[model samples]
Target: MKNNLDLTQFDFKKDLPDWQVDLITKTLSRNFVFKDFEAAFAFMTLCAAYAEKIDHHPDWSNSWNQVKVQLRTHSKNDITPLDIELAKAMDAFANQIQKPAEI
Candidate 1:
């Protein structure tokens, strides 16, 4: 199994697509907008399954048509490679499901 990666070892702006890294909170966050609540919930479901598989859950919430995700290693108290991997997975998942009009 891979361990947590130091924040200094990664480049957030270059590696992550739409994610924003918060220096203070040590979190990577992104907001995904969908066509409706159903789509948003569906996305969350997919994310939940993936998170469970990886054992790296995200702090996330869903609104009417939007899902907000925050990723960090609670044990490490900083952003890690797991957070980056999860963010990438989320972006890929969102891209796959999101409608063309929404993009």
Candidate 2:
């Protein structure tokens, strides 16, 4: 499977919250909710920059306050380490933006 990871062995629950592996599409997907559209867009921008740096882009869409991201190595026809790495980066980025203001 070249760059592919055995899905059964990967611990997605521990790796990222609300992330799921879709067997049918061979992709790891997650949805992130933010306070508003600006926050959502900012998150997407951060992901975009990272994706460009790694040359591995995500299949994603942004609504007003939500961003849905799917990661897969299309060329490899499966989920690869890149998907996991990106998912982790995304989780970190989301956490930074969605944190509650400490009073």
Candidate 3:
């Protein structure tokens, strides 16, 4: 049996269903879209600070209203607990930014 620890084909469907694991790339990735560029930038800024604090940066890109992210532990050349932590934090940050404004 494959080691469940290996994220090459790891399943995040239960908690992070929006994230997809690519065997070829051996990374977990997700694309986040926001209503506008400002919102997207805000989301990235939040995530960047957290990633920096944890010292586990992610491979990501931002284009106007969207940000695409891929998480992997470069040192190990595989996904690890750090990636999971970053992914979870990113999800929360994005969710907070994407929330609709109150009336």
Winner on TM-score between 2 and 3 is 2
For every candidate, C-alpha RMSD to the true structure in Å: 3.0, 2.3, 3.4
Please give the distance, in angstroms, between residue 7's alpha carbon in candidate 3 and its true position after superposition: 4.0
Question: What residue runs in model 3 are displaced by over 4 Å at the alpha carbon?
Answer: 1-11
Clashes of 1: 0
Off by over 4 Å in 2: 1-4, 101-103
- Candidate 2 — which pairs collide? none
Q: Candidate 3, TM-score vs. the true structure?
A: 0.87
Q: How close to the true structure is residue 85 of candidate 3, measured as C-alpha lDDT?
A: 83
What lDDT, from 0 to 1, does candidate 1 have?
0.85
At residue 26, give the lDDT of candidate 2: 89
Instruction: Looking at model 2, report the run of 10 residues with the lowest lDDT sum.
Output: 1-10
Model 1, 4-99: lDDT tens digits are: 466676777888858888889998999999989988888888889999999999998888999999998898898877788889888888877885
Q: Residue 64's C-alpha lDDT in candidate 3?
A: 95
Residues 6-31, candidate 2: write the lDDT tens digits: 78887777766679888888888998
Q: Score each candidate by Cα lDDT.
A: 0.85, 0.88, 0.86
